[model samples]
Target: MTTMRQLKKRAQFLKAARGRKIVRRGFVLQAVAHNEDCDLGPALGYTVTKRVGNAPQRNRIKRRLRALSKEFAEKFDPNFNYVLIGRQEALHEPFNELKKNLARALEKIHVERSAASHAIDRKSKS
Candidate 1:
């Protein structure tokens, strides 16, 4: 089984921020396709701002996100990078619900990407 790689650079996170965003009750997901051709698996990053809570709370949120990512590792598109921005609600949200949201978010991102590509194709053909 292929495992997701962790995104460790500030630039990487910033790049993802400029990509597609999907907001959920527990967190916001940002995704973008890889800019260069490489064989590495999908990359993931986690961020929880100070505005969310203290360090402990933020750490907790990140831990939850990591777990969710592992569970959905197989569903991740290897050609894309993803970042999860944790919200305060994540602390109280049920684990099962978070998992469901992550799954839906991943599915939605692909649908949106395809639609966007279709739009670009239509424009170029015109």
Candidate 2:
């Protein structure tokens, strides 16, 4: 249920810093992130390369990721733009597992980013 309004665009994706987090089964989840440009809220983006599959396959994976994003948006900080890149194996994964993987990846990102922000705030407060 992730809406288009919550999504970041291609330019933003290219401008973001990125990292990879390994998930269960050694699947690598890639993310490119930028701070939320405005105070409105957190926004997210997704990309499925044709290398992952053909047109239909890419769309299917995009759909799965979108659903997962919507389902877990509450867990994310609304001050950053995030783009998720899907792999070919993602196509074969069951919906539940896909959801779980997405959740795990997002959780790791959230915790890491939150800790980093907290430390920065503490430093600035000193």
Q: Give candidate 1's error at residue 43 in angstroms.
A: 0.3
Model 2, C-alpha of 50: deviation from truth (Å): 1.6
Candidate 2 lDDT over residue span 37-126, tens digit each:
545656666777767778999888788777767787676555556666767777788878877876787788778877988999999999
Q: Candidate 1: what lDDT?
A: 0.94
All candidates' TM-scores?
0.94, 0.72
Q: Across residues 3-117, which tens digit of lDDT does each residue of candidate 1 receive?
A: 6789999999999999999999999999988965447789999999999999999999999999989999888999999999999999999999999999999999999999999
Write down the worst ten-residue block by lDDT for model 2: 17-26
Quick one: best TM-score, which candidate? Answer: 1
